[model samples]
Target chain A: MNDTLMTDESRLRREHHKGHYDRETVYRILDENPFCHLAFVQQGQPVVIPTMQWRVGDMVYWHGSSKSRIAHGSDSAKVCLTASRIDGLVLARSAFEHTVNFESVVVIGEAQRFEDTAQKTALLESFFDHLFPGRWDALRAMTASELKATAVMGLPLHSASAKIRRGPPNEPEEDRATPVWGGVLPIAMQFGKPLPDEFNQMPEPGYLARLRTKP
Target chain B: MNDTLMTDESRLRREHHKGHYDRETVYRILDENPFCHLAFVQQGQPVVIPTMQWRVGDMVYWHGSSKSRIAHGSDSAKVCLTASRIDGLVLARSAFEHTVNFESVVVIGEAQRFEDTAQKTALLESFFDHLFPGRWDALRAMTASELKATAVMGLPLHSASAKIRRGPPNEPEEDRATPVWGGVLPIAMQFGKPLPDEFNQMPEPGYLARLRTKP
Candidate 1:
C-alpha cells in the first residue's frame, strides 16, 4: 500500500498522539467531506477560503470563477489544504480539559491550473458526474463563454497527513467524582431534503432522494 | 442600532450579489457553526487551523494547547477568521454553473491573547456554558497548570461580513429544459445521540438530550 509521505510541513508538533499518517486515513476524511478550507498567503497576509473540492485518483480538484482572487493567486503557489469535521464536543469534568473531537487532514502542495481547454471541459463534467452518475448528461453542455469564465485547478495528494481525536471526556481521576456532567456529544452533517426547481417536471433523481438519509 | 463596520479587507470584490452586511446575518451564521478555520501567516507561508470558538458580544474567543504553533504565532498577527457551513451541493445544469449553497462569514483582525490568568479562566467557562447552560459549574475546578497550558485568543467582530447563497439552482433559461436534472439539495448539521462515559451515572442532562434533536 502506498502510504502518505509526511513532510516537515505536514508533521504535527503538538499533541502528537492525535497525528495520523496513512493514505487510508487521509482519503477517508477527504472522501467524507465535500468542503475544505484552502489556505495561502496573499500580500504577506494569510487568507483562507472555503470551497468545494473533488478527489479523483491521486489528485484533488477545485474550481471557481475566473475573477475570484483564489482562482488567480493560488495556482502555482504553495498552499495548505485542510478538510476537517467536528465529530463531537468533548464536555469534560474540568473546565480546562474541555475540547472538541474532530477529524482533519492537512495537505501542502502547489496548485496546478488546467491549461488545455478540452481537459478543463472534461474534468468539469466529471466533477458533476462524480456526485450523481448520469446527472451531467441530463444538463446542457457548457458554452465556450461559460467554460472560459471558470478556472479549474488541481493538486497532487502525495504530501498529506490526517489527524483525528475521538474519545470520551478525559479528566483527572480526582476530578471524575465531581458532581458535574461529563461525556461526548456526537455531531453529524446530513442532507435535509432536495427542493426541485419550480420549472422542473422530473422525478427527484434517485440519487438526490437517497441523500436525505445517507447524505 | 449597532451593525458591524465594513472595511476594505472585509468587502467582497466578486459576486457582490451574494455579500451580506449587518449584525443579524453575521451573528446568525457565527453562532450556528461550532468551529471556524483560523488563518494566519507563518514564516511567510499561510496556515489555516480548525478550532472551536465562542462569540461573546463583540469578541470571539478560541483556545488550544499552549504548545501549539498557532498559540504562539497567531498573537498580534493580522488574521482572517472564517466560519462557514456548506448548506448543500448545488447541482447545476451546466458545468460552469455548478456551485455549493453555503453561508460564510469572514472577519479580518489581529489576534490578541489573554495574558491574565483569571480572565482566561473565566472566558473558558463561558465558552462551555454558552454551549450548555451551567456546563461549567457541573465540572470540577481547573488547576493552575491546566490554565497555564491552554492559550485563549480573541478577535473583535467589528469588521466582518457574511456571504450566503441559498435557493434553487440558477441556470440560463435556454439550458433549463435539458434532459438533465437540476435543483438544490439542502444540507443540515445536527447533533447525534450523546455517548456517556463509562462512569457517567447522572441522569442525562435535558440540554444534552435536546441537542440530539436540535444540534
Candidate 2:
C-alpha cells in the first residue's frame, strides 16, 4: 500500500517518527491484539464500545448482538477502531518525560454489516479458528437462530496507521546524569491454567497451549 | 445520583441486568484501569485515541501534548471515555455462548481543558502521586516550558455507567453436558522485573513494590 493513500487524520501529529503507514506494521498489531475499542457517532454524539475483533485479509470484523445500538449505528457509517497493547512503562528522571511503551493501530473506515448469514457464519467460524486454532471444530455448531441474532460488521483496512514506542525513556543529557533510578518496567498479559466448568467432562484441548505463546 | 437523570443514550439498551449506574461500581472500574480510549467527533467524523487517564473524585482527566489534535479536538466537545480490564476468556460448550469476563466503564460528558498553569500542574502532580505514591517528589520539578506544552482535560462522572461480566459462561443445560472442556481462561496483566536505565546510581524506589500489588 502506498503511504500517500493514508489520510492526514490517521497520521500521528505529535510524534510523527512513531507513525507507520505500511501494511506490515499495521496488520501485525491488529492480528496480535484481539480486543478493540470502536468509536462511532450516535445521535450526533460520539460513543465508544469495547468488543472482540478479528482481521481477515484487508478487512477487520467485529460482532455484536443484533439488537444492540452499536451494531445498528455503526453500519455503513464512518468509524474509527483502535487496538493497542501496552508493552512496558518507561520511568524517566522527570515526570514530563515519562511514557509507556506500546503498539497501537487506528483504522478509519466506513463500516458495513455482513447481511448474508452464510458469509457471516463463515467469518464467525474463521474468528474462532483464528483465536483458538482447532477449538471451532470441537464445539457444537451454531444454530440458525443464534446466527440470526448476531450482527457482524466489517471495515476495510485502507486507512490505517500504527504507532509504536519501545526501549528506554527519552531523557535529556543533563537529566541522565541525575541520581534518579530511571528504567523500564515491562508489562505483559499472561493466561493462567485452564479452569474447567463444573459440568465439563472432557480433558482440556491441546489448542490452549497456543494462548501461552501469544504475544 | 438519581437513576432517572441518566439519559437514554447512556443507558444500556440490551442486557440491562449487566448495566450499573451506581457510583461505587463506576468509580471502582475507573480507578482500577489507568488506560482509556477517548472518543470525540472531529471534522464530522468520530476519532478514538488511547491515552492514560486518572480519576479524582467526580471527574476523570487525561493529558496530551498541547499541539496534538486529540488535545484540541476534545476540548469542550461531547466525548465518550471508556476503560476496560479483561479478566478471563469464557469458553462455553457452544460458540454462541462464548464470552469474556471483564469490567468496563463508559463515561459520556463534555470535556473541558484546565487552562490555569498552577491548577494543571497540581493535577498533573496528583496524577503521578496517585499512580506512583511518593515518586512524584523524587523527580525533578516540571519546567515552565514543559507545563506550557501539555494540555489537560477533565470530564464529569455524572453520566457514567459500568458493565461487568464475571464468573462462568451461561450455556444451555443440554450443551453443558457435552464432552467439551468448558471453562474460563483467566487473563491478567503482570509486571516483570524492572530494568534500570544506564544512568547515575540510585537504588530502586520502594514505590516499585506497589506496582506488583496492583490489581
Candidate with best lDDT = 2
Backbone clash pairs for candidate 1 read A138-B180, A139-B180, A180-B138, B190-B215, B191-B215
Local distance difference test values of all predictions, in order: 0.79, 0.85
Model 2 docking category: high
For model 1, how does the per-residue alpha-carbon lDDT over A1-215 read when each residue is reduced to its tens digit?
25655777778887788888787788778877768998877665667889877788788888888888777754238777888988898877778777789999887777887867899988877776767767777776778888888888887987787888989987778877877677888888888777777777777888776656663
Model 2 segments more than 4 A misplaced: A1-5, A74-76, B1-5, B74-76
lDDT of 2 by residue, A179-202 (tens): 677999888989888888888788
Worst 10 residues of 1 chain B by lDDT: B1-10
TM for every model, in the order presented, reads: 0.94, 0.96
Candidate 2 global lDDT: 0.85
- Model 2 residue A65 lDDT? 93
Query: What DockQ results do all the predictions give, each relative to the true complex?
Result: 0.71, 0.81
